[model samples]
Structures are given as C-alpha cells and as structure tokens.
Target: MSITRRTFALGLTALGLSACTNQVLRTAPRGAKPVAELPADLRPTPNPGYTDWVQGFKSRAAAQGITETTLTAAFRNAGYLPGVVDRDRNQVEFKRSLEDYLAIAASDERISKGRAAFARHRTTLNRLESTYGVEAEIICAIWGLESLYGERRGNVPVISATSTLAYDGRRGALFEKQLLAALQILQSGDITADRLTGSWAGAMGHTQFIPTSYQAFAVDYTGDGRRDIWSEDPTDALASTAAYLQKNGWTRGVTWGAEAGPGAPAGRIIQPQEGGPEFSVTRNFNVIKRYNNSDAYAIGVGHLSDRITGGGPLRGSFPPDAYGLTKDDRITLQQRLAAQGFDPGGADGVIGSKTRAAISDYQARNGLPVTGEPSRDLLRRLG
Candidate 1:
C-alpha cells in the first residue's frame, strides 16, 4: 500500500515504493511532452523485443478486462523509455549519513519552502488531518520529501515506465503487476493517457504512489469523483497520504517521536547513524515507515516535519565521518569548491557524486592526483 525508492538521486528514490525497488528521485518535471518535450534519451526508442513484449502483455491486459480502446490509447503514446531502463539498472543505494541527509532533507531552503507550503495549504491540510486523524505537519513533511512539494513530480509516462521495467525482466513479475494496475487506472479514467505521468519507476504524483499502492490507498478528498494526485492543487495527494497513515495504524494526536531527551516519551530508541541523535519513536513513526520503510527516511520525514513546524535543528552532534571530517569541514570544503566554480551543488556537507566530481576537478586543475576523495589537506587546500 505504499511506493518507495532506491534513489537519493531521484530523491523519489531512496525508500522505494511497495514492491518496486526503483528510487523516486529526481526526474523530468510535470507536463513534459513526448519526443518534443522530453530529452532524446527518454523518448521512445526502437526495440523489437519491447514491441513483442507489449504484444504479449496486451493479450494479458485484455484478459484482465482492459478495453481494446484503452489499450490502444495508452500505448499509442507510450513507448519503451531507454532512460528508465538505464536508471533501473544503475540505481545504487548509497548510504548518506543522517547529518548529511538532514543537510539536504531539512536544509534552510527545504524547511523555508516547507513552512511556506504549509501556510499556503493549511486549511486543506488541517481539514485532511481532521478527517483522517493524521497530523498535518507529518502529511506536509511527506509531501516535502516525496516531490519537493510537487515541483519535481516526474513527467515520465506511467505506461512506458512500467511497461519498460516489465519487459526488462530483472523485475519483470513485479512490474507486470504494476503495469496491469496502471492500465486499470487508465481504464478507470482518473487521468488520461497523455497526462498519466510519474517517476521513472512508475511512482506517481505528490506522494509518489505506484499503481498498486495508489489503488489501495489513494483518496479523493475533493470528492469530485476522481482521486487526482497529479493535479497541482495537491488536495487529493495530501489526503491520500493522510488516509494511508491513518489506515496503517497511525496513532491519532501523538508525535511521531522526539530526540531522546528531557520529556521524551517512551518508545523505540533508534540511532540510525551511530553517534547521531537517538530518537524515541512512537507508533506514528512506524506508520510513517509504512510509506517508505527506511529508518533514515522515516527520520527525514519526522525531522523535516519538526523543522516545518518552526522547530530548531537537532541538538545532537554526529561523530566525525569515516573521512575524519566533521560536517562543518565538509560544508566548508563544498563552499570553497563552489566559490571557485567547481560547483559541488549545495554545500550540504554531503560528499555526494557532485561533491566528489568537484573535488576531482579541483584536484586535476591543481596538478594533484584525481582521487576525488576529500581529506583535511584537501579542505585546507580549498581554503
């Protein structure tokens, strides 16, 4: 009943959805046109095998009650996305330390934007909370983590993505089921073929529900007779998320948890990153995990929810990283690299791919070995 991720890249990625192992990370934005609007690699490419696979799947789909008209319309525009295959094959579950994760997850920009989003949608969020017995901030936090408040809701067509993965055969069985469910969504007419876009893994909308999970938990708070999670309004998306948590045993009116400290309530004590802050989690926290079953993601959602509610950053300090560098040192390194136009992305203190690339570039430019690894000497050199 949930969609999850393997991507910190798609960032829809990471904590991938229910049975789909693909991450929900970054991808094309909403309303990208086929061929014309999409990047060349993402456009449908010629694949005889994929064509044959679709021929077989169409028979199965027809057996499953998908009308011939719906099949034609859905596949008329949908084609095998080579990029989705590339993303599926190349996804690596890199472990970002909680400190680094928080730097990106609850950064000033995300928190500020989250608070703004909270204000803008307070009425609807509160109404959903009342209706579903889930906290508004928790719902907002999931919204922030899932698609950056809908700004990055992916535009890859669901039919193509699911069908491609289904044909890829690595995870064919799961994708086949998802493919069926996606067809059902089309058949039901919640969204048209052209508009039924989602992440490369077929995770859709503000909260990134894959087709099966969408069928299981999506709600139409608008009551307009359609559960439209893809719309810019986000009412249905937020409501669907709230409904998910409520159904999954979210304890009404309880905090997901707090840093284990004074007045911290009794619950599970988990320190996902050793030497990082310890959290005393409540049932609500586990309910959050039912959305994305990762301690780090659950913490990201919880902590980001806290920050969105005007809470301060975590009071605990993490031990130095394996590189023997503190987060501050890493941040300083990234800032200096970015200042010189090496561009390590945001100075989030996460030595991610971009940061490593910047490090390698700086090293090469300065006649140093291009190890791309950071060291105190490198930090000092950056100085």
Candidate 2:
C-alpha cells in the first residue's frame, strides 16, 4: 500500500519466498549492482505463449466495440517489458518511517499545490462532496499521491503492460480481465492508444484508476463525452475517486483519526498481534483499508487527511519494546525479527499479532515488560 521495503519482502514472501530465497535480504547490501544502471534491451522476452493471449485480448476488445485501428495501434509495437516484471517482483527494501512518509506525501509542496487546487476548484470539489459524501481534501490527497496532480501519469502503455502481464501466466486471469477493460475504454473512445499509458499494473490517470476502476467510476465532469483522467483538469479524476470511496462506504462527518497524545487515554486498541503497536482505529479507518488493504496505508491516508484538514500529529509515542520503534520503526523491527526467527508474517511494518508475540518472547527472555511493544527502553535493551 505505502510500498515500504518490509512490505515488499512480505509480498514476495506471500508469493512463496522460495523463488526469492536465493537472493540477499538486506535492505542495503554492500557492493551491490545498481538496477537502474543496468543496460536496456538486455532483458528477457516473453515465452512465446503470450501471443495467443494478446490475440484473445484484441478479439475481446473488438467485441467490446474497440475499433480495429485503436486495437492495432495500441498493440502494434507493444512488447513485454522485463523491467516492469523485475520491479513488480523484486520488491522495495527501504521502509519509510511514518513521519517521513507523511512528510513527503503531504509535504509543503503537495499541500501548497493541493490547497491551490482546492481553492481554484472549490465549486467543483464542493459539488462533488455534496453529491458523493466524500471530502475535498481526501480527493486532493489522492490526486497528489497518484500523479503529483497529473504531472506524471507514467509513460508505459496500459494495453501493452496488461497484455504482457496476462500472457506471463503468473496472474494471467486477473491481467487478462484488466486488458479487456483497457480495450473497452479504447473502444468507447474515452482515450486513445497513446494517451492510455499508465503504471505497469495498468492503473491509469491522475488517481491511478485501473481499467475496472476507470470503467466503473470515471466521469465526464467537463461535459465531454469521454472521461478524461489524463487531462490537466482533475475534476473527473477527483470525482471518480470520491465516487469510489462513497460506493465503498466512506462515512460523512467523521475524521479519519487524530494524533493521540502521550497522556491520551488508551482507546480501543486493536492489536494486530499480541505485542504490536496498539491502534485506536475507527470504522471509517476500515473503509480506507478497502481502498488498499494495508494498515500502514490506511494510517497514512488517515494521518494525511488530518494534516490537510489542519490537524496535528500523533501526540503519544508508540509502545516501543525492541527497535526503538515508531509506526515506521515497526517495519525494520519486523524484518529484524524475521531474521532472528520471529516471523512477523510479512514485514509490512504494522505490528500485527505475530510481531507482538515475537516481541513478547524477546522481552521475556531479556527481562522487560512483556508488553510486546517496541518502546525506547526495549530498543535500548535490544541494542
């Protein structure tokens, strides 16, 4: 969700860690080769089984009313990009501390831009909120995160990437469906082949709507026949995201959450694991999880939403037992815990049940509060 290194490792592990077991696990290895510096065109190609899938995709597109010209042009020079697969597979290593993630994601630049955009489009956002029951700042934040307010919607062709992934056979069924959806969009003339570029996963536009999301939620806020999320106008994209959250049960009049102070009374702490960081999340927080099913992601959005609405940071520090941890600190704790045989079950860094259990075990052995938290004292003992 937030794309932390620890989360990537856990994702890889979820994909069956055996495939990646031979690779090194360190976040930063000494003398490692830089992947970005690798020569282009030296990567591997599809296994030849993908052509049939591509043909099927084209046929499905045609059935959906995509013009032959659009389909042909979109797929003409499209080929499997090994780099996309590599990125999709290799996973990230550096975990963004919560503060760091928020600082960048909701930075002055983003906030300044967001506020300007919000002010400029006050009428539109207001209408959208009234109609969709989703807040303006949340929409602005999504816009900021997805494409930096539409400055970088990616250059990779959506059809090509989806086709490649569909043909690759790893997640064929899923990608094939997405490929068809992309073609449907093309067929509808909502966007052209050249303008239909997006992330490797086929998520497009200012708010990174995958084909299905685009088809399901995209709007013609500009009164144009087509839903143009790729345009400089963010009205359609923001509206679409709002529609999505509203559809998914976003509650009106409720804030995501507030920064808890050190003296704040403990709310209903939902510990993912026995010794993980305690969170007092609300029902709306669960709604954010539906958007991206990760605790950190939900928390990030919640925290960012609060900041955009002029709220302060968390007042109380996280329970630290080992790793001198904060919210972000849990990611590294998870990784190190895994290395130490704790197996926190996919190091996405939100201290779930297994992580707490591991922390408790570590604390019991080391003579500390078996609170299973990663407090400063625990970090000192761990050190």
Candidate 3:
C-alpha cells in the first residue's frame, strides 16, 4: 500500500504542477491571506444547472416530514465551499505499508482504551450482541477508527457541506438526497442544526455515518425517541453500527483471518492476487467493506478488532520490496520522477499502473531490473 513515485506526481498534476503544494506555500509572500479566509460572497458559487437540485432537495425533505422551518433554519446561511469539493475530489494516497496501517489503526492506544471501554460498558455491549448478533470488538474497532470514539468528530456542518456539494453539480443528485436526510434528522429533533457536523464529504456522527446512512440504519437504543449518534453517549451510534453490519449480513462467530507464518509449508502460503493473505473474512468483514470499499480499510477494522480481543500481528511477510513508505516520501519520489519527465501522471503518491509503468520505463533506461517496484537504489538514480 506504499505510495509510489507516480502517485505523488498525479497529486501535483491535479494541482497544476508536479511539486509539493505545501512547499510552494512556504515560499509564497508573507502577506498572502489563506485560501480559507476569503470573503464569503467572493467564494465559489454553485453551478447554475444545480438550481433544480436544490429545489428537489427541498421537495424531498418536505415529503419526508421535514418541516419548512427546519429546512430554512438549517440552510438559510449556507454557502458553497469549493475547497470542500476540491478535497473530496482529490484521490487519497495509500502510502502506509500494511504494518504501518495496522500499527496506527489498531495501535496499543486504541486497544487499551477499547478494552477499558468494553469493561465499563460490558452490559451495553453484551445486550447489543445478543439483540443484534454483532460482536462487541468489531463495533468498538469501528468506533475507535471512525472518530477515535467521538473524540474528534469533524466540524464541517453536514447541511452546508452536503448542500454545497450538491450545488457544485459533481454528483449533485447524491448530495441532494443526503441534504434531505439531514433535514429529516433535524426535523425529528434527533440533533439540532448547530450540532450536526461531520466530514466535508457529509459523513457525520461518532461513526461518520452519512445522512443517508443515518436514515437507513440509525437506532434509538436508549428509546429516548431519538437516534443520537452525536451525543456524548455512544449507545445509539454503537448500536446503529452493529445493526448496519447485521442487516448487511454479519456472521456470528468467525475471525477476519490471520497471516500464515513464513516457516509454514508451501500450501499454507496465501498468494497476493488469487489466494493471497489467508484472511478469515467473515460476513461481518463484508459489512465493514460496505462502510468503505477498500481492502485496506476492512483489514484495518478486522485486525483492530482482533487486537482488541488479544490477537497479534501478521506472522507472514509482504513482498520484499513493499516497504511501507510514508506519504511525504511518495510525494517526493513522484516530484523527482516528474521533474525528469518520466510522467508518472501526477504526484499523488499512489502506485497505479501508470506509476508502475513509469517506474518500469525508468528502470529499463537505467539498466535496472525493470521490476516496477520502487527502492532506495532507484530513488538515487532518479535523484
């Protein structure tokens, strides 16, 4: 999962150059105002074609029993945020090696806290497990990863973010639907407009549930007539996550998979592509994938859950050259390659086929192995 040189280059290309944007900032004039501080009216406007989308959102919210008072109160001062769109549209650089990803995502800090939380809330977790048929560790692992158990829910207003994304006309329909769901949540008095904040991409709550996800899966476990995923009490959020997995087909009792030790027989080895990484990947694992459709993410959740329950790290090893590279290093490599005209497509730090191809081309020209795997030796040549 290391970010290759090509991935980094693509990120830079997206920003109109193959250099680190942050570096450019450091060299800029000292008096320059930050992009985020510009006047509101001067900011990016909605695409004209999305007027219909706004109207549609209003209509849907009304039909879903969201009052006009709630909708107006939520969106009255909302404005388009082009920066949010830019951030969402940007591709992520998967530069963390499996070990690094696991270490951070399933770190000891998380495990210790998770164990303590489990002990304190054993009654609630056990009740949820029996009622919903979802394991406590999986729930806790997701809770830890999504917002560090509600310690850092994002500050972007869900209503405004979804409205802005909808108005931007790139996936307008999707955002519009989310906007309606958000209004419904407000109407139901589950969360007030001022408290409804989340990621710029519109996922909210301790578990980062999108508005649509809230509509479809939120649970009022405490029976207070509201599903309060954002409150200090995480009962609703945890229960909702469990319900989501259960509804999506979580198996009762199976591990996600463990690594086969290097010393094991050849038949025990799980190959990378076809039969790689002999993971147990139960039904719940698939449900986790539904939350974010990435093998790395699902693996992170599963592994973190195992760790919480006293499991250890993988015993087998990844490919020899696949050292976990940091995000910054991948960006550096991509910038270096693009400067030399290898054209890895932009400096995003993801090792896509183009990046691999660029690496192969660079290796062939330099009389190297042409294996397309990045290394310190190739980096020296590129430098």
- Candidate lDDT values, in order: 0.82, 0.62, 0.65
Q: What is the lDDT of residue 83 in candidate 2?
A: 62
Residue ranges of candidate 3 with Cα displaced over 4 Å: 1-65, 92-97, 260-277, 322-383
- lDDT top scorer: 1
> Over the stretch 143-174, how does candidate 2's per-residue lDDT look in tens digits?
66556666656556677677777777666777
> Estimated TM-score per prediction?
0.94, 0.67, 0.67
lDDT of 3 at 366: 77
Worst 10 residues of 1 by lDDT: 15-24
Is 2 or 3 the stronger prediction by TM-score? 3
Q: After superposition, how far is residue 365 of candidate 3 from its true place, in Å?
A: 29
What TM-score does structure 2 among the candidates reach?
0.67
Over 4 Å off, model 2: 1-49, 60-67, 92-104, 107-109, 260-279, 319-383
State each model's C-alpha RMSD to the native. 3.1, 10.1, 9.8
